[model samples]
Target: MGMNAASVLNHIINGEPTTPCSSKGATSSQAKALTTTIINHLRLGRLGKAVSVLFSAPVPFPFALYVHLFRICASKKAIVEVRKVESHLVSFAPTPPVFLLNRAIEAYGKCGCLVDARELFDEMPQRDGGSWNAMVTAYSQNGYAGKALGVFSDMHKSGIFAAEVTFASVLASCASILALWLSRQVHALVFKYGFGGNVILGSSLVDVYGKCRRMGDARRMFDEIERPNAVTWNVIIRRYLEMGNGKESVFLFFKMISLNVRPLTFTVSNALVACSSFRGFREVIQIHGLIIKISYEEDEVVSCSLIDVYAKCGDLVCARTIFDLLSPKNLIHWTSMVSGYTLSGKTRLARELFDRMPERSIVSWNAMLAGYAHSSQWDEAMELIILICNDMRNTDRVTVSLILNVSAGLSDLELGKQVHGYMYRHGFYSDLSVANALLDMYGKCGNLRKARAWFYEMRHFRDMVSWNALLSSYARHRMSEEALVIFWEMQQEATPSKFTFATLLAVCANIFAREQGKQIHGFLIRNGYDLDIVIRGALVDMYSKCRCLDYALNVFIGTSVKDVVLWNSLMLGCYYNKQSEAILKLFELMKEDGVKPDSTTFQAVLLACISQGCVKLGGQYFNSLSQDYFIIPQVEHYESMIKLYGLHGFFDELEDFVEKMPFQPTAPMLARVFDSSKEYNNTRLGKWAVRHLSFLKD
Candidate 1:
């Protein structure tokens, strides 16, 4: 053979050899040749043959051979070969060198055998900085941040001067735990060691500060960087966006662009998120143009952000166009499209897309369930909830919250109780949103006692929504005194939202409590809530119902933006106040304001005509309901029509209207006809009304 041990080791280290193998069962010379062959095999990446040749060797190999094998095994993270080499090293000598021990420690740590690594580290008689660094890096890499920090402290106390790598690893551990003070101490050490100018170190510092919500400090550190890379800018922008300063983030993005810095996919994604915050349609479009300019339109994350922003802006057409054009629709993109459709009130399209999805995530299912709940499709929502509970192994809190909302909408107390039980069994009863939804469900279903019990039981979990839910329950039931008491209690516990005030005003309106309503109005004016459209509508209705037409008119005229609902509210108030002429005049003014009349508007105007006994005017408005505004008459509209005919003693017309009514004549309709007959002393009409009433009861 041409190879000696030195040359063979050199060849193994170089991953190549010049010699061929000899036969097995050989002399010492032949064993040497075979050992060269095994090294050569190992060098060629044939691990199995090398191990086989090593085990089948006639005698134990030289110490150099085992050392080289150990080095190779450690590098490859071959734990079995490492252990085998360790066994050979142990039998060959009483003690292994520090270098071999360090390699073994590192190999074990890299292979996630931390216990073995720690054992070897502790068994060593002496160690170097490399030993400590490997352990620290291992602990940090494996999510033991606090342990890594403790090890670093021990290394410092052991008189090992920390290197740049050591400081870097420690800084990473500190950042992971959000140890702001410790990170600051590390920063001081970095400058003391003159590594403060290092770009990687600076980036880590910025990240730590950003995560700790010290944006000002993060910005200052970022400015100190000589040439911040794309990642640096991305970090600062993301930090700003996370801190809810979208405008600042967008401005910084433009500044980065002005400096000719290339934007990455994350940069564009973050910028799109910033655009979504302000609903700046112009900025969103401009950023989209930039995305197209940079050829990131095809990127999945960027595309998803664009879809999300468009959906939030209520531009479902654009959102759908983007979604349709995506080639390979991922789960996230599919979920976004479903959510967009649901938000736009296109439940049918959402359901179709949901059914067609190749795979469904919990989020996708939750989106569809929430859509049904929001649209008041309680049956469909309940069906999907049952399917999810049975088919899916786990469900999140959002799913439970949505189902609870459906139960509330349907006022199905039994179903709500069942869901409550399911939540208790599934460990979701502690979720505040679920609790609030349960309270709302019970309240809406007329179980205020249960609602009150649940509310009081939520000692710490009660948030603003919980208080408002209970308050709205009282308001809805016209428990005026109880609502006022809850209102005051809520004011002491949590700040009342506009919704709370709106509910309270509704309670006042129902009970015709003028003093309480005026006090609330005063509070509204003092608190600058007088201009909220909901509060304004509630006030107009309350005052008009209280027979204070002048006060209601002032509030109505003071309203700058009079939607059809507000006009209808005022007109209805006038009807209730017996100002029938004012109702017609308000209708003319509404037409002048170009506010399209809804069914409520038509109902209010028709009610006014009935109050004044103006049959012709009421009939004209009823005709216009379909002809002028194209609003199909609802049940309320038909009821008003019957009342108009009955009040005017149009017995022939009233009977004809009853026969031609689109729906079966309800009890109120028969009562109206009967009362009209008694007023006019018409016994025949009364008998006809009596027959219809009897038929309806049967």
Candidate 2:
């Protein structure tokens, strides 16, 4: 068996030649014996020796032998062996068959060597449907959807008609690039080829529509599959899960069960993930119970999803119970448990558990690091980041993205630049999410130059998030001209989301651009983005800050449901416009609407009280701050009361209020009081303020 094949494996490792690839004058029976020996070695998992024996053999292998080796290597994804076998067949095997060339193409594709696969396909003097399908599958499997479609086009023009497998492979390519238009074209071809009744082909059509997010078309095709098997059921179920319709996905899962289709490991895991997506605690429990009854809980993937769902639903006790029960734990189990604790905000326990793990992946590290970010423990996060940067074996795009976000949260621009350097070094800069995170970090840290550079670099592949990220950067720094210009450019390519309008509204408010704000408002109505509360509130805020209190009030009145933030915005608008009476009236209307007032709501109310010199009314509201509303008075609340008292010359109330403050008066409070006393020619209160100020300075 050449058990010591690893010893001579240096023949391939160091680019040395093996024995002759041919044994001249060898009999067919002898060749068959050698082929059986090599296959026996391959079946025993002695791939090194099998390859060693393959290239070392005296006899050239049969075409069938080459097929076997290539098939096995394709399954094992042994690229080195694949190249070795490919070279041998091309050099020694005179007049290789197209089917063998097709096998070689399939092998290279499975090895993620699409370049070699395509090159081999191109060199084939003749091809059948298999050759073109193999090339299309090679490209599609390796994430080259455009290339796959290109080969399919050539296949069509070459007069080699598409088989059912060709359409299935082409649909997969369509799904990958989300090419809905091309997918529709392919769907017409599927029927033109008269494979419409094929269940698996129909499922592939469903996949193309599903991934394109045209779920209505997906469902239409899905229902056309009259006798849907497990694969078909899984396709629809998984697509719904991907689309984040957890309830629908779970319903399909139950429907599959009712139809007596026993879900496999993949089906159970997908169903569990669906349950977790919407935090369906009751569904999760039912699924968990079902899995336990079927002994499917013992499956590692199902167990991992169970832990994740339970942790996400805030049942850490149940999650830990599952985690502790697993035997011979692997990295997935450990990472899942750590992520559970992190998601639950128990970073300390997460860290302790993480330290105890025998091995760690970038995912576990990311989960722990994200906990620090969530808790705002930037210092601890930076220290963990140092450890991560040192041990970067598993560092991926996720790692780069997480570290960039942490740097942003810390507001450490230097650290962010270092991470940017690391990303460039590690080839993560091209990852869209990582690049967007880098852009966001630079923007948040007030480094416009770096953000703009990344924005330009990302333009070709940029999505809505990338455009919004750059827009947010401009808005944050009040680069009004740049924001407006970039938004106009964004509209030509990416559509603005609700949050995009929110950020734009902030830009409008910051620059007091009333006309621009009006346009955005009209755009919202025209585009049907007016329903979002946050966007509507942004519209109110934009008009309010532009001194158009009337427009702000109209938006506030038009919104069917008003949150406290919206009420505060309108009230603050009145206060800014010197319509102090209107602010008080809005507060009463807010109460009548039964919207609970938060701290900011009262701040606006108190500012209005100060404006009108409503001494008695202000006093009653100030008392009601804690008595009736139970809103604990903050320092700003106390300062507002002092200003109200001192402004109207209520000296007794002012003195008593200052004395009754629970904490020492802030400097602003004292400064305002002393200034008011001086203006009113009150020597006693002025003297009292000066004494307190001196003592506070001491």
Candidate 3:
């Protein structure tokens, strides 16, 4: 057979004429022999020889020979070979049968030759469902998701008979685009086309739902997939992890294990991540053991993930141990270790390691830069930025943003301007995130004119963060009217987020504009903001500052999860309104409700005590600072205590309290003692205060 392959090619393809049996071309013994030899060479892994013998055929090759050639080239993803076969096939048959042309289209698509695939498909006199499927699959697999969807639209208009593969490719496109609404519609079409029971197609449906965040629907589709494979299990588990349901994600991981399904390495990485987010050290330890048992500990991707989760769990020792064991020490492991050290504030050692890296990616450079930025090593960070700008490799937006952060930290408007120029020169200013960072840097570094210039320059590209950055800048400068006008303009374009409303309320609070505060609060509620703890605390603080104590208290009472901030806000409101008795009662309620008191909480409590002249009660609460709650008394707490004793005419106790305090009495404390001495006619204590104040400046 091998000899025949060599001999058959020399007869026809080597400048020898083919024997034409009829208009249908050769069907004689010679053509059959040529086709056989070509298949034999292809089967023997001699693709070059097969093509040689194919072109050297003594007659026009049969259609079946071309089918085999297309199938082989497609399987290997051999774009060069597919192109050769295509040119030869087209030169002979300008209008081949649709099925044969369809095969050629599919071969091109599989090789990621989308342009060639589309060209071949367009020139076809007719197309079946396979032709459309081939084009969609080409775009879908090449990550041209929008293009795939566009071609699928054309497919629908052509009224071609769609096949199972066509829907499958289209479904994949929807998944890539995260078009959840469209995914649901395609899912309905799946059942209507009677492909509901096909497990492969069913898994695609599951993947679509999972990536789109419909975990419940993803799980249901997964369960219906008979004999669910590794991919099926991975889809739901990863989605749950993405949704931040770490417990459920880990639970699914265990369930998959119990069913005797071996988790893929990808699945193990996600499970390790979930363990970091919600589980304990022991669970991560178990995953480490599983990795060793499965022999995946050496896999770089899984190893990197284990290192990240270990670092996140505050076990950098173990993370470093795993990082050291990797043989090749690729960029990922290097970046992960540097990031881990930077996060843990071991910047000196991180820099040492970063300096020794064999190679560097943008992420590696960013990790090092971030370490310097986080540790506030301004000299090293600034120097590194200069080095990065001079390097041959390109720095991405993250690098530029971190550099901007360093400039903002130093409040160096000159350095920031240089970076802005770098951005404009390199074309990164077009990216919205890069533009947003520049705007924030300008605002922070005291270059408001430049900030607004860049902001208005990118008006067409502004997202919510863009508007918020500008609004926050105005708020920071106390440009109340300007901020209000910006907010109104923002409402016409983008919906206000919780942060947006919070900034507006802060603006109102600063000016004590009660009406504007109420208007913002109304807009906040009307827009259905979730009123998370941050927003709720902001609202309470705003209302209280606006002198609406009743409204502030209403916000406090309506909240089900009253954190310490809420209690403190209400208590401070009471102190502001001179509701000393109510402040005392709320303090008791806060303790009873098990809300631990911080320094701010006790300040409000002590201030209320001083207002009411309750010296003994104030003393007991002061003792509770170290006794029960372990909160160290700040200077304000000591000042409040002196006022409490002095206003109530307790002269001797005031003198003793000041003398036995952990430190020497502040001038303010001694002065309060002097006032109480004059009011109560205690000349002896007045003399003692005068002695202390003789040399101490108030």
Candidate 4:
């Protein structure tokens, strides 16, 4: 038909026929012809002309035409046209058929007009399985998972048999809310209805079970499917990856290949991720070869996974090569490479790439920020925060969490407070991670009061990290009683982690509470936590500080895996117990056991030497700090050296050492020298020490 004929047909379809002939007794042929013409117009993107035709149709238009019109409107989310269609349907036929009314409901729901959709659903004179399913699917798809489940319950109570689509929708709703109990109930219904072994339904069940962290059930569902598709295998493999069983995921992928189920982009992407978890170059190279064999190496997602795996496996050269070879590097490719560089501790390279990014996303910005935070480059992290704020880039929980860690590391309470204010203003304070990070930041910055306030303010939102953060702060600052009280409170509220015990043990060591330390140690042994390295280290330190040298020795000897830190802890304990000779013996034994001495090791040995008045041994260990062990001398190390020299009355050596020290002398170091000089009755050196000490204090 021509444009004129099309316009007249639209007028007639909309129920505003311009001619009596158009309104009178339209034949089936004429109705079909008009429907085809209107559909053709709709297909050509002439939505306005198509709607005009529908609205201008004769009264009581074909039910099929209304259905088609609703479908088109729903796809386009043309709420206005949908409303017009509904009004026309109502006015022309006061009571439409159930199918027609269901179509209207579906249109409204699809357009996000749930209120109107629900109203129409309630106003329906009669309901069927399709009508109920429409409402359920609508609520589920729009994030009203709870309401979807409620409607499904209502549908069940009303005695309507749900179809396969209905079951899929319900399973999806269960998955959305992570309602494991509800999903199990649905699984029972699916089997009862003989939809068991239905591959599609089985896959949906596998997905929900996987999401609920019930991997055993997900595996059971997968095995029951006689001929599972690639999608089903993908879900199970991805599930294994999620559960951190990457080896199993890779095995499954190989099994799928043996079955000749061709892998898709997601399948390859997930397998590469599984390989990445192994952190072995051999595994990543094998997966990279497979990507090449399958010709998915160029696929953006698969390539990004390769880059990440290579970087994680400590092969940055390969990762960069893959990134450079990408045909048209999108934001994801750029961000992945930046993250790879950051992960490998190449922050300068990461920043160069970040600056070269033509289009930066929040993810890219976060990658750079996280790199700086991970490397403890606090100043650079703050500078990035300023750039982000100036550029008005959106910040998410990861960004805020990274910044809070930076603030904590730098002990910048002022900067932390400003970030907290930003969080409060931007509605990010309610997020659990951000809230926990704030608590940690305040605690690390020495604001225990503010940390406690934030903790109590979290109320029911508190997680294990929240409790541990506050408790660790108390332990770190040596508030023994407060730390114990908080530990008891935490025990009452939540189960403690090994870190909790370690912190509590530190508190005991600080206060020299041997009895309390024994109690905590007993609890550790009783709870089967004695083997943990951190708890073991803490136990050694605590017993040594509390003067229970026998207990500390037993614990240290009992540890199967003795790293340098553990040896240092035990040596420090001996020093505290005045067993200077034993410190020297343990140091020799530690070296014999192949546990190389660290900075703490040297510090402990030097203290032991000072205690025993072994001047030559002290000087030998102090000089060997950098030469033998390659351990740089920190301020504390230098202080120990000064104490060693001054205690022995080696006035000339002590003076030369003070003058040639790497760093400028602090007040504490000069005060120690002054005290030592006075004790030895060296008036000239003592006077010089006093002058330097005065200058430092000023």
Question: Which candidate wins on lDDT?
Answer: 4
Of 3 and 4, which scores higher on lDDT? 4
lDDT of 2 by residue, 267-384 (tens): 8889888887888888888888889888987788889988998998999999999999999788999999999999889999899999999988788888899888888888899899
True-vs-predicted CA distance for residue 185, candidate 1, Å = 8.2
Total backbone collisions for each predicted model: 0, 1, 1, 12
CA lDDT, candidate 2, residue 420: 88
Q: Which of candidates 2 and 4 reaches a greater TM-score?
A: 4
Worst 10 residues of 2 by lDDT: 10-19
lDDT of 1 by residue, 1-698 (tens): 33565575764444322222223435446556667788778757876677667766545455556656766666677877766666655554456667667667767766677787788788878888888987887787777899889998899888887777878788889878899999888889789879878888888788889888999899999999998888889989999999999999999998998898999899988998898898878888888888889888889999999998898788888888988998888999999899888877788999999989999999999999988988888888888888888878988888888887888888889989998998889998899988998889999999999999999989677999999899888878878789899988888789778888888888888888999999988887788764688888888988989889899999989989988878988998988877888988989999999888899998888888888898888988998988987888898988898899888888888887788877888888888889999999989988988998999888
TM-scores for every candidate against the unseen true structure: 0.72, 0.79, 0.78, 0.85
RMSD of each: 7.1, 6.6, 6.2, 5.0
TM-score-sorted candidate list, best first = 4, 2, 3, 1
* Candidate 3: 10-residue stretch with minimal lDDT: 13-22
Expressed as tens digits, the lDDT of each residue in 406-478 for candidate 4 is 8998999998999999899999999999999999999999999999999999978898889999998887777
lDDT of 1: 0.83
Q: Residue 425, candidate 2: how far off, in angstroms?
A: 5.0
CA lDDT of 658 in candidate 3?
86
Per-residue error for 200 in candidate 4, Å, reads: 1.6
Error of 4 at 357 (Å): 2.2
| lDDT, candidates in the order shown | 0.83, 0.86, 0.84, 0.87
* TM-score of candidate 3 versus the correct structure, residues matched by position: 0.78
